[model samples]
Target: MAELQTHYPDVVPDLPDLYEPLVLFYERGGEFVRDNAGFLDLTGVLFRPGTLRGHLGAPSLSTLSDTVLDAVDAEGRISYYTTADGQGPLLRRRELRDEQRDELFSRDLQWEPTDRIPGSKEEAKDAGLVELDEIAAANLIAVILSNTSR
Candidate 1:
């Protein structure tokens, strides 16, 4: 807390209570950020598309602007596809392989609500968890905090 306050005097005080501990835990590099229950809950709460959109003043696509899409494509780290109806671009993964050479192909992929638990698709749906990319969530929080501090 002292380190955060000393390093980010102007910004630290403005951060909500829910955000501070997680930020500190992450800064300490104790372990995987996902291992922190508070961080996971914060991610589930604030990183959802609806919640982010609200924080971003209700933009049509929140932080997912065309410029961001183009930049992501230019980087070539991932591939994104546009919907035929022009809804938005989506990250499409064809396959992923584990250390054992077992493959999870596109057809075999099942969208689970949360990675914290093992459950059936129906159970996942009932869990009501919002799947969010950790890096993306961190970026979103930074953006929001930056904007709010000003």
Candidate 2:
């Protein structure tokens, strides 16, 4: 783990497309956008499962799946993940940093707590927040088949 951390630039190519895996699920090769059959797949960027966790500290696929699967309701339009509505628009306090950023993702008292639900925004933050190195969605696709051959 330490070795990968030390020599990451050499061993692992930066995956801007794979940055926000939650937004764009990992696939070796496929259409960048596919808003059909339930999933709004913005896939195309992919990394070997082992390499991802080892090199870039991405969550294990299982961990990711567990986190995302349920939150996505049947409609799939809204799926909440770790960190919801941070600090309510960053209220002005002379400086951005002084805007109480750390307490941003605090679970709202209004919402019933489920004792640390798997996909809660808190879990995503607690388990090491992944800063997404990702591509602009518009550049990729306008609704295409994920696996045209399949």
Clashes of each: 0, 4
**Candidate number with greatest lDDT:** 1
Q: Estimate each model's TM-score.
A: 0.20, 0.18
Q: Model 2 residue 38 lDDT?
A: 42
Worst 10 residues of 1 by lDDT: 99-108
The runs of at least 3 residues in candidate 2 whose Cα sits more than 4 Å from the true structure, single-residue gaps closed, are 1-10, 13-63, 76-85, 89-150
Which lDDT tens digits does candidate 2 get at residues 1-150? 445546896775553434555454334232445444444444423333334347565423332332222222112122222224321211110113233112121222112323232344455557443222222111111111112223
Query: How much lDDT does candidate 2 score?
Result: 0.30
lDDT of 1 by residue, 1-150 (tens): 667877999878754455654465456442332433334333122333236547656322233333332222221122122233422222222222331111111222222222232243344235442322434433343343344457
Steric clash pairs (candidate 1): none
State in Å the error of residue 72, model 2.
Answer: 2.5
